[model samples]
Target: MLYRRFARPLLFRLDAERAHELAVSGLSRGWRALPGVPKEDPLLAQDLMGCHFPNPVGLAAGFDKYARAVAAWPRLGFGFAEIGTVTWRPQPGNPRPRVFRLPDDRALINRLGFNNHGAGRTAGRLARHRRRGHLGRVPLGINLGKSKRTPPEEAPSDYAESLKHLWPYADYVVVNVSSPNTPGLRDLQEESELAGILDALAAVNRARAEAAGSAPLPLLVKLAPDLEPAQLDAIVDLALARDLAGLIISNTTIAREDLASPASLAAEAGGLSGGPLRERSTQMLARARRRAGDGLVLIGVGGVFTADDAWAKIAAGASLVQVYTGFVYGGPGTARRIADGLAEYVHRAGLASISAAVGTAAEGGA
Candidate 1:
């Protein structure tokens, strides 16, 4: 109520990127003063990719692209934080006015193009956080992207280099081959290409584990929502074949269909996210879950604003749920509210645990 009635109106008035910067700055400096959410219900706890998450809600990649507010996520009630879509090298990203808001539709279009401070720098910052004991309790995953200047054929090596640099700091690593803003990035999602990338990262993960005498870093892939069913099926097959950790289910969509926002805003050239993406993303999640079965872990993202939306995804096969644009519009209480709502829904449904609800709707058992 406070966000919609007060904070949102003010933030919405500013330019989108500028408003984001202000929010990030404020959270980074004052996160400790923020109120904590209710104690996590054990029913909501999840053991995914060998890491124990206190809840199922996580902050998706792209929000904390540079790891500036690692500690703030748990305070704000996220079960985990996936920072970065960081590349092997830093780039300025798309030109100004790259991010725009469509308040009428409760969506955003961003072509920000992985504008982080590069892998090496990001690792340094995370190291500092670790040294200060400010890394928070929830697991931290790093979403790795290929450098823009790196050629398509070399994407495997490009991604491998980043994993090597960031391996120590990440609880898990996400291979992002689906950002629509980067030219030819999505091409890496092809069966053979994606296999190569995953293969390379798998080798790196194994070497790191052997050297450290620890478990290999769990590796997952993020896919684009605009893919055909055949494309998605192939990727799922590759994930299983390579023995990868799981899939992130989706990135933002390039499709602009059925939006309530004006054509001018919808016509913008970038990936579209938030409320308009809910149905499509959920459908994809259900399909992936059906294809991957019980073996693969899936994190459903796109257009998740409320507990009901999160529940829809969970029932459709998402083991975990993530939010990006929804967090932008829903304010600080969003995660807590959604987590609490999910726990209440689980209780009402007479389920043993939140995991019992996964895929029930998709499997026709709901």
Candidate 2:
């Protein structure tokens, strides 16, 4: 009640990226205050790709570019955390003023091109956290992207390099071929190119699993919401046929249609995320679910800002869900509120477990 009525409105007054950094810093300090927040009813824990999630709400990548907040998240009540869209080399990303607020649309647009302290620095941070035993029970997934200077044809090598170096620290690895801010990266989602990338990583993963005497890290493909239906169908078919672990139903979109932002702001060059993305992302989830069927897992993400939004994704076919903008907008209590709300919805709907709701509505749409 306090966040929705008070904090959110005040935070919305600031420029989006600055507001985001301020919130992350404040939440990192106040995470311990969460235990005293109301506990939502317990929902069944989930197992995805041989890993257990305490619950289904996950912090999407981009929130923690350098894996700086891993130890603070579990206390914030998220079931999992994914950090980075980190490149092989550290780059400043796009120019300042690259991130913009679309408050009237409750959305954000950013041309912040894959900026980070690079994969090596990120790995060192995680290694420090691991040695100190600081990463909480929540699992971690690392999102890998190609360096800006790497040519499109060399993407496989770029991603492979990331996987080779960062694999040991990540519970899962996401091939982020879809962020629109990166030039030519989305083109890699084309079947021939994507398969080559996935196939190369799969080989490395298989060997790594054998060498470690355990299962390979679950590999998920992050996609763009801007894809056409035929494109989406082909990608799902590829995932199923190739036996990839799963799909993250979307990344930030390039489209600006239907936004409530002023015409000038709407014309900004970048990807859009937050409230305006909810319905479109859910539609993509539904379409992908129909094509992928029960054979592949889906992690729904895009514009989720409330528990109802989260529930809508699960019904559409996401076995798990993630949030970036929602957390930015909804504040620290967002995850707890969504998880608690979904748990109530599950009980009221008479579903035995949250998994039972996955794609229940999608079957009809399918």
lDDT of 1 by residue, 299-353 (tens): 9999999999999999999999999999999999899989999999999999989
Model 1 has a clash total of 0
Candidate 2 TM-score, C-alpha based? 0.94
How many pairs of residues collide in model 2? 0
Candidate 1: which pairs clash?
A: none
Model 2 gets an lDDT of 0.84
Give the whole-model CA lDDT for all candidates, comma-separated: 0.91, 0.84
Clashing residue pairs, candidate 2? none
For every model shown, what is its TM-score relative to the native structure?
0.98, 0.94
